[model samples]
Target: MPYITGERKQGLLLPSSIEDYINPSDPVRAYDAFVDQVDITELGIQTEPNRVGAPEFDPRAMLKLLVYGYSYGVRSSRKLERATHHNLSFIWLTGGLQPDHKTIARFRRDNQAALSNILKACAHVCLKLGLVEGNTLFVDGTKVHANASMKNTWTEKRCLESLKDIDSRIARILSECEQADASEQGNPSLVKMRECLGKQGKLKEKIQGVLKDLQAGQKNATNTTDPESVRLRSNGRLGVGYNCQSVVDDKHGLIVHSDVVQASCDSNQFSLQIEKAQQALGKPCATACADAGYASTEDLKKSLDEGMDVIVPSARQVKDPSSRVKKEHFAYDAKDDCYRCPQGHLLRYIGDHKQTKSRIYAVGDPEQCRQCPLFRRCTNSDQGRRVERLFLEDVRERIEQRYLQADAQAVYRRRKLRVEHPFGHLKQNLGIRSFLLRGLAGVKAEAALAATAFNLVRITTILGPEAFVQRLAA
Candidate 1:
């Protein structure tokens, strides 16, 4: 068949297609819609809600935008504002209008405490949903960035130097003012110089105040922050960062409890985190696991006191080879509070309160130490041979007792599978590298948000979309 010429076969002109897809369904809208169902504002965020003021923006709306934005990795406030105007999802979520960057930034900064409370509220909701199964809780600490800096910080000596610099600058400003006065005929520069001198005086006052505070804190503090924060190095580098501690449930990898601390090491982190986790669940933890870093005699005893079966490696001792061989080679006597020498001479206790307070116990008679052939091997002190037993010796004994237990090993093996898996998911999939906020308070809030985000993912994974929607609605 040959090709036919075109003919007007169309009857009445069909109506133009009416559906023009101007705005597609937005994920931010979907997320915000989910948040809108929650009654977080009803929980009373602002302490004084009735103060007469200009028409205030809804805290809930701001909260919804922030949580949704952070969940999707849109962290910058300025960027979020732009997205509200341009992105369909953000536009839908923000109700076709964009809040200014100052408003968004103020929401985050002014409401830090309120935002923190909201996190706790979210955890309570999770508990209400029966999402937390506290069969095992793994505790660990990670370093996060702080607001202070290595450069801004000053050590004891550096602080004095800073004060001197401020004083010298103030003196120079005063000298300039004096020189200006000598040549002044209502000189404009003289007025400026006086103002400059006034500002310099204020700067000197602030520097002096900081110096006084630093000295006071250094002299009084049982634990001190080097340069404004304690001198603790992480990842083989010295920087100011907080150690964020978390105790996560193993069953669902949900964080049961979390805290922020200024401590540089994990030595004292165990008991506090474990106890908090236990308290949150309202039950005693049957078993707990930690790395060698948290292993300490005091913590082991505290864990025992809490009725928690702890699994940790033994603490290392700092001694030269000779002392190591001498004491370790011989057997320790608990009842006698002494050690038996290899030659079978009983090492007796000699009272020395000063050494004892330092956790060193004086043992063996001075005469005995003076006479023994092995004196050269053991005794380097002018006093006598001493054996320093840890105050909580039984704690170490208990740790050794648990180290041999099969259940301890089983729990420890579960630790990597439990806590690290969630941490890996958060860092890799959720994009939590460093905190968006700074300082202890800000970092704590960020940690809470990260935990909440992780839990949201987990809740979605476990409950599926439909069930999670129902749970959130409920």
Candidate 2:
């Protein structure tokens, strides 16, 4: 069989207009049209030329480049810079203008506020399309590696030990200088001693700075490279990374809001993220769905107090196997202020659990516990089974009751699919498993860009590029 022949590069003929090469339904058109429609000036992108040295590139054009780069999964400044030179879509998006890598990087780094506006603009389009009216929003986070090395981590223990080592070296250096001045027999020279001492002094300052950060209580450990980042464990592997959070609307899996946090704990982020997500969506989320990781007293109480039904199970409930006896098996009797075990044993309230700030309840007699059938599976203690009810246990219990309903379960089940898809797209399909920027601010901006791209693509898919842009114009 003979292979088919194709036109030579030099002999190839194509449309004169670049727009003719891009399909009408291509997602880049939506990205372009969206940026063009956005009031880049109000979004903080400069519309006028600078009075200084060089005429500035249109912020609108630069905004297009960043959003399109994120949508295309070319996040690095250098990669995006290269894309402008040859990538047909990028060339079409920027109208054949190729900015350098430095310019591309500076544009992204400087326009985080405008990027946020772009995200809000995407959410507005979704709202107009009725994509965010589901009343259920899923909030979750994933660990994305920072532009920092895991080996650059500093702990309190390591910090203290390093300080001690530096102190000793400094002392030795001082002694060497004294000896050199006195005899010149053992020590090399005064200048060498001074240089060694200066080096040790700088090392001591760096370690002490790390020590100060650790003591500030933001994180127990610190990375010298990215100070705001913490040690995060994702997919059973630990690394220096930030917790990237997204509040996804359930209707079409649209990201209503996005943020990046320095803390690894998800429980503390619900109220903060929900407030922002609601702001972006322009309406409150009636029901919030998250996994067991977000079941905290502060969060659950706040959600209930706000009249928003939050569906979240405790980690224990989600992780315990069917064969294992879970905390849920021990039912709480609010009327009696006691707990009923699997064997119908009542564990009465004993005393206040001061350390845990909870009420402790236990079987009065250990001897009665010895007669139980599920004792071995329930507890290994000779003191019988004990349960600690938090001060806000009622809040968690209320959410727990709501979570058992079939409707709530149906909504809750959608959390993984609705929320994880953005991350899956960003990390797997878009090739952004790790962030291209460093520090919390830079990563947050990067996440916003990714989310904006996702929402823009989703809108195009639902409405088609031409249709969405037409709606934008309409």
Candidate 3:
């Protein structure tokens, strides 16, 4: 049998493999092509120095490999390194070379400052691409895992008991060491005693350190590799995780301002996120939407003061009974400037003032409620029902007015579509159920990288690489 050759010509192309049709193009190759154009040495790369004092691989190339690896759910540096050998896209991207896992891990661990700068670069790209426009912005937070376990949380009592046990163990070890020193064959056992004593001493030092921490009012005793990470509650359950906040653009669901927080509640987060959105976009957005988590009187006041529009629902719980009362139930007395309840009793202002800015109209007619059948349904308090109104009742009134408006409802309906996609993709599709990094700073860097990767994915889907690169350059 004769072996047939495709071509007798020099520099001929090899035949395509069956695997070539599995994927139309190598995704890793596309990523590498994107990363090669940017020089990250000026920005600083995080990977370790080359082995045997050899020149390091291109930082941008390594970054492209890491990100593209992560995009396809390859999180472990070791796994990513393995993928480079066999994965065709990865092979093409890395030029058929594999950077070790340690190098990959060190790049992320060491280059905190550079990673932050890179995140900003991606954000700039989004801004230039018009993904982040200063219009409607959605604010929300999600929880990510901390480095510590829920079991490590030590209470004041637990700390005391744990320290006590350490002290007792140290005392026993010291006593044994002294006994060994006095024995007939002391020298041989002396080394063992000394070793035991040294270990005990180290334990004592650890105990003292913890005791001092408790004395200094350190409520959290989490001793993890990342010390800055705090325990935050998510879904009403306590866990060690970071609270990541994002202000997403309503236009393309791209995150504009992203931050990681240790704060458990969204109350204090609103003002900061709004401020970030303003800074990120270089202008306060025309309209900002947040749920009741960001709804506080002070936050609303601050947003309005900054010349930005806000759409936060009334906290519902803070509303006055006066608003709940039917209009027909209130009888106005023109002469005395008083109002009467439906029970035919005059309502007068009590000497006490309600803290809200609105006027307080109290109907303290003890006899009126005593005779009315609705008293039980109205007030459980013996002092009778007190109606306190806000000083700027009109502010809340206006908010309610907007809530009732058709346009506002429509905008609210758009909220889920605008903001939830990124988070859903991040948590479900991306497999980032919990954070692998710990501490506030580390987690912040991690969150930013995640958001950057997410934006890149979106930009890739919306416009091909050609358009995206042009936008980034522009």
Candidate 4:
């Protein structure tokens, strides 16, 4: 019933190397080897041991710290800095060099592009190791809480209110200046007045800029703390956050690409992310799977036209409330370019719905529509039931059919498990539900490292620790 012998605080200790502490099977060993193999200096990270003012922490060591931290969910710079001082694996990774939090934070902030390039390099490594099969690739997105306070969130109405308040202040200031000028020519306090004007001008410009952004439909809600972060709903709760997208090969669920988008929706995210995956993997994906959120006519056109098999379920239309009749209950007539209601009424083509890029069909005879037994059930609208079919409706229909197939559903169902490998581990296991960095750029830097860390863990898991280390050396 005795614990392992403890060392005395003041006793002379035997000389020991930190490297002795890391096990051969430790994932950190593979991570160290991976960083050593990557040419980070060429990827835009400047490293020179001779720099003045402070000892430059080697870029390789810094990258290892970041990536290793992310692998276990230790993303805070301060925490990573502390890890250098006490964490055994970290001490071995850095060789006892402890860079302050500022240094750690600056490296990540300034080398985001380089860090992102490292993630691409990881994809290439996956391909090299045969982890990426170039077959079915699952693309998915999840929202992470941004490093912003809800108090800073501004709605369109809030922006307008701010603008109005600024304008009134400006008016009052200018009127006071005019009164002062009239009271005395060459006002003795003209310099102070000019300073006041300048300050007001800058204030007005900032408010106007926010107002302009709100008016331009940039985002529904913007946070002043991190202007690029948008208010989005994730896990059925509204919060200020960024959308993080990931592309994973179905074979090993290894991430091939990732990015932090400012937008809240995945509708327009597929094109850019998939293209990056192709560029990284050095080959086009044979097939791609995504959830219903990613199914947009514009994006589907691009993905399909690019020759990638896509299985994104189209957005479900609202079903008739009274009768519980779904839009699918209606039949489309290609020859007539109309829809036949389940109740046997002809809904003729009306016009193109520009917003949706779809053609509208409506029942011309409200009397006939009301006569149907499913009238109020089918549609409560007095104008009769209407349907909007996309000009590219055939593409959606094809995708819908493909998604319903036994084979396609089998592949599609794996999307959550496949893509969520990184996110679930990052969030639930690593306790990274909220980002520690603010602004889109900072969050992106964090994401690049976080993803690279994930790839490292996945790589080691697939190859085993010893082989992973040996492969990096190879």
Q: Each candidate: how many clashes?
A: 5, 0, 8, 0
In terms of TM-score, the best-performing candidate is: 2
Instruction: Estimate every model's Cα lDDT from 0 to 1.
Output: 0.66, 0.84, 0.69, 0.83
**TM-score quality measure for candidate 4:** 0.86
Candidate 1 vs candidate 3, lDDT winner: 3
Select the stronger candidate by lDDT from 2 and 4. Answer: 2
Q: What is the TM-score of each candidate against the true structure?
A: 0.75, 0.88, 0.74, 0.86
Q: After superposition, how far is residue 16 of candidate 4 from its true place, in Å?
A: 3.5
- RMSD for all candidates, in order, please: 7.4, 3.2, 6.9, 4.6
lDDT of 1 at 297: 71
Candidate 2: list runs displaced more than 4 Å.
Answer: 1-23, 50-52, 168-197, 216-218, 322-326, 329-336, 340-346, 354-356, 365-375
Pairs that clash in candidate 4: none
Model 1: lDDT equals 0.66
TM-score of 3: 0.74
